[model samples]
Target: MESSSALALSQLPYYIYPTIPNTNKNYPFWPAGKRRSSQLPTRLHCNKMFVPGFGEASPEAKAAKNLHNFFTYIAVKIVAAQLESYNPEAYEELMEFVGRHPLNDGDKFCATMFRESSRHKNLALRIMEVRSSYCQNDFEWDNLKSLAFKMVTESNTRLMRDYISETSRAETEK
Candidate 1:
């Protein structure tokens, strides 16, 4: 009879397990399946990217890489800010992308500085001010500025493409 009962239990589609009491006396008031706030997954505070040759590169090479990252980060910020006024949804998506993407120390520093300066009423003036402060020389500043412009153009293009595709899809649905 015991063997038959055991076989019957095994054949059941689902079995309910007995709930065990929480063993930790420290959190006696806490509910089951709940965790402390400190145990939760924390969001990254900054966007830091990993450059392949950064660690082993010469000082000059490292500086060049940092400059490139800084301009790229600034470009992304500029594009994101532009989108915020015209298309909030696209702006949100861009911000999410920025949040997810990895950046290096240089990029993080640029982002932090930009964030601070962006509080000013005139974004263009602040950007120029930041450029002046960071860029080593006029030629270097011009080159980096061009790179930032190129990045903004490319990002805008991609956003436009996505917007067009979405419109087309809506049209098709209609």
Candidate 2:
């Protein structure tokens, strides 16, 4: 009875994932068309791709790669900016890009600098730091000015949060 059952199970159509199909370069592996052919390897070739611990490259891997490249770009720009002479045009461009991205810390600091016109040293240092870390562009002079501006600008949320908290507390007390 066990043997019969085993045989029956074996006879049943089971799902199979073809490791590689033998067809031309363009076809769908197993010869879907005469004009088109595709190649599928039965086994993964290490020379072709090496996947270690994980089964496959995850989305996280892709993201990490992108982030790494972005940071590298920033670092190169920073070093170049610092070593080279001051250029107003480069600072402007950096500011425009930052304005578009509008990072909270970056934006706030930039705004402050623009208003106070202080912390030029801080701004320069940060510009180098940001570039060293993750900046990836041929920064413009205006953007550097903007970065300085953000350093000095007031945070809008600071006052708003305080007001809301004070009003709520008063209402509760009443």
Which candidate leads in TM-score? 1
lDDT of 1 at 121: 24
**Per-residue CA lDDT of candidate 1, range 8-73, in tens?**
332333334223334435777787577676544333333444344546775568667776667555
How does residue 85 of candidate 2 score in lDDT?
Answer: 63
Please write out the lDDT profile of model 2 over residues 1-174, one tens digit for every residue. 322223333233445442333345543464443432223212322223333455466555865555544554455356447544685654664555455543434434345445544444455456546744454445454786797577556556677788999999999999
List pairs with backbone clashes in candidate 1.
48-103, 49-103, 49-104
lDDT to native, each model = 0.57, 0.50
